[model samples]
Target: MRKKYVIIKVFKMDERGVKLYQPDAQIKKGWLSLWRQMFSELIGSRELIWRLFVRDFLAKYKQAVFGVAWALIMPLVMVGVFVFLNRAGVINIGTTDIPYPAFALLGLSIWQVFATGLTACSNSIVAGGSMVVKINFAKESLVIASLAQALFDFLVRIGLLVVVFVILRVVPAWTTLLVPFALIPLLLFTLGLGLILSLLTALMRDIPHIVTLLTTFLLFLTPVLYPVPQGKLFAILNRYNPLSTLIIEIRNLVIVGRITEPLRFMIISLFCLFLFLVCWRIFHLVEPRMAERV
Candidate 1:
């Protein structure tokens, strides 16, 4: 018997070799399944949504020196500053019979709620990037969580407003009931814008900076520190600025104890609903790409 030796050649594979050899059928199916699963998972995970909301609420003041008292303190400080400025002829409140401090407080209370809601919700997805990438819950829940925290802050600030109102001896009338109705459109409007901004900011890192700048400009445009004028420019600003109608309506019903313009409220409400639908659709469209981008 003759001994024979056989040599076999083995091919070495690079990192890309495995990927090239594998079929993408499972990957394509997975992505399709994930897209279909999003809505069902969102509906099924209400508990996680609530938990995230509560966590966000607590996180707002967790390590702060003043804790939640900062909420009450902030609006009070704003009212004080505006009152001094108005007295000094820096910012005029026009001929309104209400005291300057009270007027300022009322405007700040409503404006701060909307502003904070918009700010927090806009950064929500970016802030939750870690969870978004790692966790399997509904992404929309992040926006809801952020809004809930903002609402909590709003309610706390309202309590401070009640204290100030009591001290000022300004009795709220039946029109006070309309305050919540007025707030509905404002909330919807803020949440819509927040959703739009949140998704955009996640895609474009520069958006958050632009948003901050725009928010500062918007504050001056809004009638938070002064009454809306009746001039041509003011009229145009009021009609177009969503916050203008919302703030004016809130001040009229809550602080002024009257409801002189119901039609404006209806128009604002309709606009907010339209914005909500548009933002919701946009959010759904961009959400799939969020994890990939973030």
Candidate 2:
């Protein structure tokens, strides 16, 4: 016993190193511990998030001849087209005394942001499948990157909007300060819906097409091209459509220089938050499986 001795050796493995040890069990254990790991991974990848945002920004304009200038011009052309249509009486933007172009453009701007964000995020995981499968990073980063791209586009459109406001001599009111506040719920609403749709699309593959159709229908349901009519049904739809309320609130603040009805704000904000929390829970639950599916 005094002369005999045993030596045990341990080795660590790297990406290229031969595997020295492996866990054989398939069923994941320690639910709380797994969640903590996921959360920590997300927090640690903040720099990666910034890089993703920059990549999305450049990717949008890459190889495009006009580059970011296209962003400035596209909205003007859209507004010009709307003006022509409204002046020609092709589409009647409802009863406000504001110029049809201004009214339509304001609503369009908000709708476009939400729509673009939804569309981009819904397809984000499918489009970034390689990263989802091979990379050890937050899956939510796909949706966040899509949103960052949409936000950049929205900001560019806002600059064009300011130019239009000046050209039309439209004076923004002090209430315009609330515009950013109004945007909070809208972004939350969009993010919630986007995350849900994106996850569904990743599974169904047909959901993206369905989402496109639904968005088209929602545009009409919303008061974007026209005002919400004053009737029981229209009023009900308007109140229920988060985008409609968000757009209406933004327009009221920026164009009419008034805060939206407090009750409406409360309702919309609460609804948005509720939807966001629900979608967030769903997202976290499904995210761990995304790499396998993608």
Candidate 3:
């Protein structure tokens, strides 16, 4: 038999010394692009997201006189205002199963996770415009990274919650471990809404100002400072409002030892997941144009 030799060729850079990566057709816009974008974003941008998270986290407290103290300030201010209002007969929070201070603070802590995360993620692209245009990287990292600040703030408030429990001589339920499941839907809801707002905010500068006003209005509309109302108006609003359901359930889990409405929370969880997918799809399709818009 005659001896035969085969030679294999390895892909090398062109004469100009530039390496070419294979184009990913799946990344283009389509119905499935949403899942592709999510996979790319979550899997591919893991390290980038962490780096951005760290950068934003450090920069947030770097030059501030109060440093991380600012994280606790807003919730404390709300607590004080509500306490004063309740005392002066200006407003009635009604009866809570737990102490008013702990009840309100617990609700506010979870609410801030949604509120602050939404606000930061909404401005992520606009705030990081210089880098958005200059860096060729996953844009969703900006939004995902913004959640780190909210999570950190939430952890700080949790410490305050423990103090309130101790001072008030109230014991939280064993069901507190289930709080994370409740929080996941809230995070998804915030991210879904944030992605839509961030895209719009990048294209239109006025969106952030509008978001600020909306956040203030939403706090009152939500049942954070008060017990869930039984009036016709509040009943209808709570029926339609997803945040109310999540917050109320989380508050119940922590204070009352069980979820008040398991079915409602399950529905909201599904809705939030669907909403996130739709928002991500729109964001993925529009992302190519974002650098120019910003």
Candidate 4:
């Protein structure tokens, strides 16, 4: 009878390659070491991450006649339709602290960052194609690089938001100075969800498409195009939805003078930090197997 063998691939435990197998395999590295390697590899791979970012960035805009302008187009159209409906009484989006156009555009800008980043990260590994299969480098770089494109889109939308503010002649609140700081939680939450979605997406090619559709559906529920409607329904709903809290508070900083839900925002931000660390660990653990799957 021929003996059978099962080969398992894993990250090396040390400078000398060491593999783990089932019950008897002892992990020589501590949890601190796991954390250290994750950061160290990411830091060491900075150049590769940059190269990937630039390659994808140029490849995306260079092929487009609209170039970077594509970023502002979708949100601009959404703002127009919503504003029209509000005026025509076809719908009531409620009142905003700023002009509705500025309000909706700003909200959409923030929301799209999450939407686009999620899609980009989810598709990243599969899009890397033969490179993922052949390369022995940090796969997280691909997710990060893809996410950069969404951020580029975000910067473009920021310019549009500024234009809307100017046209509306709305000077933002004094707290607007804190806009950059206020945005940290939003960015972290998006990255945390993006990391987890990327891993799921690698296992199933259809996952990215589903994420895009789901985010679009979520936009309606999220108060992105409107102020939260009156009554406990939306208030309670927004309270539970972390994305709603992030958008509303960031917009509040820009226009409303204070965070309406500071406690909730703080809680959500802390949760996002925890989620990011956990998701990152999961991604790192499974990264060695990603090449074969992708």
Number of the top candidate by TM-score?
Answer: 4
Per-residue lDDT tens digits for candidate 4, residues 1-294, read: 954432223344655766454421235545676688789988998999899999998998898999989888888898899999999999987767788898889889888888888888888888888888786788888888878788888888888888888999999899988877877777777777787788788788778788978998989999888887888887888777889888888888888789987888899989888888888887877766665666
Candidate no. 3 TM-score: 0.89
lDDT of 3: 0.84
lDDT of each: 0.75, 0.75, 0.84, 0.81
**Candidate 1 or 3, higher TM-score?**
3
lDDT of 2 by residue, 1-294 (tens): 544322111122346966342222122323454446456756876887788889888877998999888766755677788678877899776576466666777787788778888888899888886877888567778887787787788888788778777887777778878787888888888889988988888888998888789878998789876776788989887766777878888888887787557788778889999998678656865665665776
lDDT of 1 by residue, 1-294 (tens): 954422111112345753222212233324344445445655776887799998876776787888888777877877778778877998667865566677777888788778778888889999996878887556778887787777888888878778877888877667888787778888888888898888887888887787788777887889887777778988887888878888888888876677567787787799998998678656755565676677
Which tens-of-lDDT digit does each residue in 118-140 have in candidate 3? Answer: 99999998888688888877788
Model 1 misplaced stretches (Cα beyond 4 Å): 1-45
What ordering of candidates by TM-score runs from best to worst? Answer: 4, 3, 2, 1
Give me the candidate number with maximum lDDT.
Answer: 3
Query: Candidate 4: which stretches are off by over 4 Å?
Result: 1-25
